[model samples]
Target chain A: MIVIELSERQLKIIEIVKENEPITSEQIAQFLKVTRATLRPDLAILTMSGMLDARPKVGYLYSGNNTVSIISEHVKRTKVSEIKSMPVVVDEQTTLYDALVSLFLEDVGSIYVLSHGYLAGVISRKDFLKNIMGGTDIHKMPVGLIMTRMPNIVTTYPHETALEAAIKIIEHEVDSLPVVEKFEEKGKEYFKVVGKVSKTNITRLFVELGRQK
Target chain B: MIVIELSERQLKIIEIVKENEPITSEQIAQFLKVTRATLRPDLAILTMSGMLDARPKVGYLYSGNNTVSIISEHVKRTKVSEIKSMPVVVDEQTTLYDALVSLFLEDVGSIYVLSHGYLAGVISRKDFLKNIMGGTDIHKMPVGLIMTRMPNIVTTYPHETALEAAIKIIEHEVDSLPVVEKFEEKGKEYFKVVGKVSKTNITRLFVELGRQK
Candidate 1:
């Protein structure tokens, strides 16, 4: 896909079409005091970009498609699997202190907890801070005791779009999401944490998108 | 600015131009077995988008401009002032516990510490967790004693682009940046924290840009 800045004449054509629907090329050219040949390329660009629609014999109609849709299309096509980073995971039985050590070592905002090889809970710096301030014994308590358990955690799959994952982060007020794969055992469903998507990843992608060629 | 998906013929035209630089419209038309009139709009679009350079006497030269530059232009045009949110601030002398309370109440990842109305330091959730784990006396110690001091903070100005700010955040590996105004007094420079830009803000903007119209 290519992006083009609409020329003044092209923009004016859109305005004219919006004001007068079903107007033919001859009428538009006459209004602009130019021949149909002169207006041909402008009309072609407007129609090709979906800004205007041309009918059988009925000239042009403004399609109401705006410039923002193009950007939206570009962003939504990026899948989460393409940008997701490795997650910091710890077994549910690990002590809170050990988990905190791993968090610092990995320099991640959050860590996923697993039980029997399935995602059981997620913990974050904020959770650990609150617990420590509340006098919870980090050395003795298992990470699972204070974690936000599964079924309450927001998650994204490898196939999900980055846009969808970013929306979840904003709406749910979470720092990161666990990218998981679902499995069935004894007619029960469980998610296995595979990777992670965080605001850091999204911000990094934004930087990359904004980088000049 | 408007974005349009280049038609198959346009893509072919670009490929042809790349393989054979300085090719005229007539030659391109002959190669495609179409009249020059039929290729007018395609040539207009290619030149207009800067993907091809047309010299007065020299035909068409592939410009090497890619699709990514358009997105970069759109993202870079957005300034930091347009999206910065209210910053959470605390006085340097405030006890660490009180500042943590403010951090929780505002639900922000970082807090700016002020000294006599000037930015003096910054503290994040990780900082607090580390201090707590190290057995710092949160109730007795002041925020200044444990915060990342001034001259070390990564900051942004209102006039700077969001893309520039996001780059700083990624490079510094920080969660947020204090939006500040620099002032000089008695030959010493200081910053007055005005607002904040965070990964959350960048992610939110990304979502907005990606949202379907």
Candidate 2:
């Protein structure tokens, strides 16, 4: 009946440990992009919470029970804001050719449609493929035409649990979900694009939970 | 001072457990696309290995120590040949524009250059951007002229450890390393493309290792 709330950095540290146990604090600090002193407090906290075990010379080891349940709870209780990746976005007026270049340059599978900082829609690889197959003028066509429009776009609030967002990805068969926040302006509800979640994020969660330290 | 050899299926099952503990055998079978009866032995083996704790209702719990060390060792001992993605390849005679289309279509950062099944060179995203920005005629240009030819291509053997391959990625500052096998023909050395290992692959390896019972 022990419930521990872990920070994102803590979760990342767990993944690092899972990948390289018996690893020294120096190595952990290097991976975390922090000083060893800065990581010391976090390490102490994890060890105290029984999520990690530290020895004089053995470095650290996993020694937790029901870690899966903890992970499941983490996915259920943690907010989307905590784990979402920076959303790749584009203006609605961007040309298809420019969008294509952006996609390749950014190394992203999809890009969010943002019009004046508002969530407008989403454009995916499939959308591009379908459009190209139809022989649309890539140089002249705007991305807004081919993007999956809002209301049809599946989105989650920043406060929602990651599990809920993850379920959306599976159910919709989409590679990512944009995390949004709604606001009222001129009696109209509009969503502000914030972040994103992908299969990679879920897999990373699983990797963190898999550790026993 | 303990060594454990885990099969790919076993590793996958561990991931499932980490994501959804208190999960039933039937559910695991469904996820694995196998019969419950077929999964029973694996469940039993895991439960007996001190890696899992099973109960009538609570299902399974993680119960292992030094799992990270074991995973690190797993990376060091396991051969790249056992876990590599199918190489994305193209012929040297292929046009640069066609190669560009293939790169985006395949969603790969780099492609292997093959000449009659022999590894000849490699073409990456940078190469495409450089050539395109230089105003080369994409329609008439062959990929061979722009490729990083043999003796410059970074490669790993199927027999090498994943850890070694990962190190190569860091050292060479490449997104992936092509797995190849060397052979001699008519007093000349040649390489045959087999597989590939990218950051995604290494991350996947870490995820698999993070799992407990």
Q: What DockQ does each prediction reach against the true complex?
A: 0.57, 0.03
* Fraction of native A-B contacts kept, per candidate: 0.76, 0.00
Backbone collisions counted per model:
0, 5
Please estimate how well model 2 matches the true structure, expressed as its whole-model Cα lDDT.
0.72
RMSD of 2: 17.8
Q: What pairs collide in candidate 2?
A: A51-A213, A52-A213, A62-A212, A62-A213, A63-A212
Name the best candidate (by TM-score): 1
Off by over 4 Å in 2: A1-85, A100-110, A124-135, A148-191, A196-213, B1-79, B97-110, B124-138, B161-175, B184-189, B199-213
Candidate 2: tens digits of C-alpha lDDT, residues A96-126: 7788788778766688989888999998765
* TM-score, one value per model: 0.85, 0.49
For A64-138, candidate 1 gives per-residue lDDT tens digits of 975545463456678899999999999988999999999999999999999998999999999998887788899
Q: Give the distance in Å from residue B50's predicted Cα in candidate 2 to where it truly belongs.
A: 19
